[model samples]
Target chain A: MVSNIEWTTKEREVAQEIFDRAYERETGALVEEIRDKASLIAKLEDVWQLHDYLSAKRHNIDGKYDFRDAYLVFVFSQLVKEGWVELNELEDLSQDKLKKISALTRM
Target chain B: MVSNIEWTTKEREVAQEIFDRAYERETGALVEEIRDKASLIAKLEDVWQLHDYLSAKRHNIDGKYDFRDAYLVFVFSQLVKEGWVELNELEDLSQDKLKKISALTRM
Candidate 1:
């Protein structure tokens, strides 16, 4: 089992904001795709892709959101690697955590 | 494991038509749904729903489409029950299979 993250109140709020921003961006892009019409098979592909993405994101975000401090840095790094949460957005986090996240994203 | 379906060429053709029709109709409805834009959450819900539905249909149709004679009756019955196929459309199939399929659909 993974260890629980040690989170300060301010850090928790920042994490929440970062998570929300990433979600909003992801869903916003999906909505735009939905608005575009395509062939039936192509449309099915989009739906399936979106379904997979959202389902996966749901499972990933499910346990991570409740202030699991240990997982937060990795989570932020993952979001950063995907271009969702920038390092600047996570500036409020501790330098130690930010450095690790940055290193992981680079790798 | 299920038994192999005994299929005559005529019956196989009928099965193919039914399968194609069902696929076309199912995908048609989904495509229509795709064209209608909803809220982000609602759109995500639709995308997930479509994803799950298409995934299931693919698995179900995978082996069923091979004209396995034993499974054909049940397959047709299922399609009939779902309103994707009509009894008259399957008239080319043997009465033995048709009666069984019709009974299963009623059940």
Candidate 2:
């Protein structure tokens, strides 16, 4: 399933770099800070804003890192690693299948 | 900062339940499916859609779980666990501060 995506080698490299940068931080402190609901929401809002920004930005360089894509992969990889979403449900499904599933889930 | 938000105990409980349900799934499969750029973007789009749904839904019961908030916290927790965002920068910041930071990061 990992190989099915369209990430160029450069994009993967960029994602790796972003991943590494994130890894260097003390996540435990952040976890500790988010003990209450308000902080958690604030952080989520921040992430959402970032996601929106990345989604809107255009990349001009061919085979270059799309920061938005790289960031999503970075975050989504963590979601998988931390068990937030079901992998089996997502795997084996084609993009069309995923879209159908997404449509069904929409309110 | 965690305590600054408004999540009730019931909301926390709901988030935990959702977290547990997600944990029971095989996330590795989902991760494998998102290997390329298109698949990754698709998965992200799905997540964003879900996030939007949760954000829009309202909970009438007092102290009951707000699925949207619960889900955000669940996902945000994973983001912290996986080192995607810097905790220190977030921990001491007030919501206004965070908003400012978010604004700065926005394109």
Candidate 3:
């Protein structure tokens, strides 16, 4: 809902400058164009945090970081709500659980 | 909250197969090694949706997809909750907002 079609010249200029830098730096080339600063900032943070979170979780062996992390709770809830994971027989999964879900989703 | 520490061999074997594929395909190399099937499934779904969501958002131009998408509302709320984006002065920001936030975070 946030749009930047009404930005003042100074604001728009600054925003354009940033976009140019993104194109030059390729930091967020995929999400460079945005309607407003709020949404753009929001998307940037989402990518930034997601990249960090994924990198950290990818290495966790105990499942303590991704499974129990506060930030991922919403994502976990979404999956359980979607029936991707069993609710009634909730037991701690072994290291091999991922393979099953991947097959299911890939199918 | 879900864990699979008590899975039977049949169940664990099935799960292991799925993990092997992920390792083989590199679909989710970052968030592997969960303790249970349920948790692993949940984590995998998180990464899956997040990857889809980010790739889509990263390419959005008008900020329509990333800002207004229902899934990102939680993320947006998180940013606002964390005070990374201004709440009281909620206005549509230009692209420059990203550079500002990036500079702030990079510090």
- Candidate with best DockQ: 1
Expressed as tens digits, the lDDT of each residue in B1-107 for candidate 2 is 43245555765565455444443232332223222221223233443443343333211111222345424443434433444444343544345434533443442
Winner on TM-score between 1 and 2 is 1
Per-residue lDDT over A48-104 for candidate 2, one digit per residue giving the tens place of the 0 to 100 score: 443343334212111123245424443534434444434343544345434433443
- Candidate 1 residue runs with Cα over 4 Å from true position: A1-6, A34-66, B1-10, B33-66
Residue A58 CA error for candidate 3 (Å)?
6.4
Tens-place lDDT per residue, model 3, B52-79, is: 5444534431242232222233333344
Give candidate 3 misplaced runs (Cα > 4 Å).
Answer: A1-46, A52-107, B1-41, B62-107
Chain A only: TM-score per candidate: 0.68, 0.27, 0.23
Off by more than 4 A, model 2: A1-3, A26-75, A79-107, B1-107
User: Model 1: per-residue lDDT, tens digit, B30-69?
Assistant: 5555444322225656655644655675566555555466
Q: Which lDDT value does model 1 have at A7?
A: 74
Best by TM-score: 1
Q: What is the TM-score of each candidate against the true structure?
A: 0.68, 0.17, 0.17
Chain B TM-score of model 3, please? 0.23
lDDT of 3 at B79: 43
Q: What is the lDDT of residue B86 in candidate 2?
A: 42
